[model samples]
Target: MIAQDIVIRPIITEKSMQDITKKKYVFEVAKKATKIDVARAVEELFKGAKVQKVNTVHVRGRLKRQGRFEGYTRSWKKAYVQLTADSKPIEFFEGMM
Candidate 1:
């Protein structure tokens, strides 16, 4: 898959925001994406951002209910990308902080 297809989108949340200071960014990756794919994708997508390591997690769908109807959310893969100490921070997330 292409780099754009591997890295889906950034996961912006209270917890994820806090990790930015540590040069760690969270992203919702493709279900089949591996750690190597994520690291390459991040580096390619964000110029000047050199990835040091990548961690991945599989989040299972959660059950939800509304009145008598109930369903589970779609399962997805999450990637934690750590940048090299000397690498510049991703500009996309800079304005968010």
Candidate 2:
């Protein structure tokens, strides 16, 4: 898959935001994307940012109910990308911090 197709979107949460300071960014990735795919995608999408490592997590769907209707949310994959110490930070998140 292409770089843009592998990386779905950035995950913006309190935990994810804190990790940015350490050069670790979080992204919601395609279900079939592997660690290597995530690493490559991040590197390609953000120039000057070198990816050091990538960790992936499979989040299980959770059950929810509303007025006698119950269903589970869709399962998704999360990727944690760590950048090299000397690499530049992702500009997209720079203004957010």
lDDT of 1 at 3: 98
Candidate 2 lDDT over 6-97, as tens digits, reads 99999999989998899999999999998988898899999999999998999999999999999999999999999999999999998898
Worst 10 residues of 1 by lDDT: 33-42
Candidate 1's displacement at residue 12, Å, is 0.6
Residue 76 error for model 1, in Å? 0.4
Q: Model 2 residue 16 lDDT? A: 93
How much does candidate 2 score in TM-score?
0.98
Quality of model 1 by C-alpha lDDT: 0.95
TM-score, cand. 1? 0.97
